[model samples]
Target: MHSFSTAVLALAASATVVLGHGHIRRVVVAGQTYPGFERWANTDQSNDVTWSFTTDNEGPIEAANVNTADIICHQNAKNAPKSVPVAAGSSLQVVRFNTQGGFEHPGPEMHYLASCGDSGCANVEKTSLRFFKIYEKGLVKGGMADDPDWNMQKWATTEVHKNVQPEGEGFIDTYTVHIPADIKPGNYVLRHEVMGLHRAHLGEAEFYPQCVNLEISGSGSQQPNGVNPMEMYHASDPGVALDIWVDLESYKIPGPAVSSVASKRDIESSPTLKTHARDIKHWLSKFMA
Candidate 1:
């Protein structure tokens, strides 16, 4: 399972509203959480549970000196490194996306929403698009092959990223939700929703989910720090260098590729590889064009 770790901050409000696909199709999308309501109790609570990740950046990367990020997180099961466990008062794993501030001011803030959306349930918390992609697209497999819906993300974050985080300005965001004195203890999925726009009327700017998970217990169940809980983020861009062999070489692609094969080096630089540097340049040029 892919996970992240960070400490808890204070909780103030619950993020609200629905994604307004305009159609309430019961397509079973997971990881969409909002404040006030959460779909509590895992009646089935499948231990058969498995986790996967996807990000804008899914490749070999160094932890310093870069900014253009990949945000994508499918560190494959084999590719995923074993990290410390998440518990109350320890460094918890949280996957977050930086709001480019392309949208309007006071956008949706980032929060560690519990496991359900209001429409989805009364006791559950909000979920994330990252998690949704996992459900809808299936574990981002096959050597950095891009998910078709990866395109949907452009519509949400791109516009808002303009005003807030901009090319240089540091992004400011807020997350909503509390563990509630009654929240059950155990490993639960949490989202790190980040935003700058607040006006619900200006489209769905306030509802995007840039999130991660948590294993809450003890003090973790208490109210979090209102904002900025000592977070350290990494660019999701795959172009950055790294130390791990797979991370440094095999971008975040999972499984094998098309009816073909090659040496490890060849696999790392295949024709289909989603090289982040190339992706950024191509995308930038296309935008400029």
Candidate 2:
């Protein structure tokens, strides 16, 4: 009896650790889903576009490290060796994994793009990359209520499999962003980030950033100016350090304004688009040709 009780307690503790954090599981480009680096497995992903991280456990780069290179991606991030072809003005989906639940932290999601130039993003210098904000969403509705949908977390991190029972089956959440139609074709690094501000009032905002290599193909020729990734946010920035628990009128998202060339979608009215893998493959072949 004593041993069984100990085993149950141990299982609960393990479950807590797994449910505490989340990571990217895969990315869908032009309807084709590419697997993200499996940090938990630490497997070889030489052909994958998502950058690899050193640790198996998913964690955030604290706000204190905002000025460091670790903030650009996660800790000890390695650039991907390949880039995936994505057409301009197409939707890119990022699927997140939490094992048994949705992303519990409330915050905003922001996407940036850094041109890798003629050399490409596969081996580009991490510090030399200049990133411009392409998309940002925060505080969909302003109010002082406990309504989950009104908060940024619901807008960006809601659970997709709420009906799945037995806990850990299909715990996935998806966020989509469209490539700007007018941007020039080139190799670019897509930086997708989510800021968890639950502890911001306590001076410990969390940043989860991941990078993907993309070869954009299009005839558009507008390249927006970018800022150094390290300079994108400061510890004291109003958006970086703020309390979301109290009655709030509005919340500002950190970083530069959305680029002029970005494909703007209305979060309030736009329905989440879904695509078939077969159709995506057909379209991609013609687009690349």
RMSD of each: 19.8, 13.6
- Candidate 2 residues lying further than 4 Å off, grouped into runs, are 1-20, 145-155, 158-170, 266-289
Predicted structure with the largest lDDT when compared to the true one: 2
Write one digit per residue (lDDT tens) for candidate 2, span 124-201. 988988998888876554444242333322434323223222335546667777888888999999998887666676
Stretches off by above 4 angstroms in model 1 are 1-104, 107-178, 194-206, 219-289
Question: lDDT of each structure?
Answer: 0.25, 0.72
Q: What is the lDDT of residue 257 in candidate 2?
A: 84
Clash count list over all predictions: 79, 0
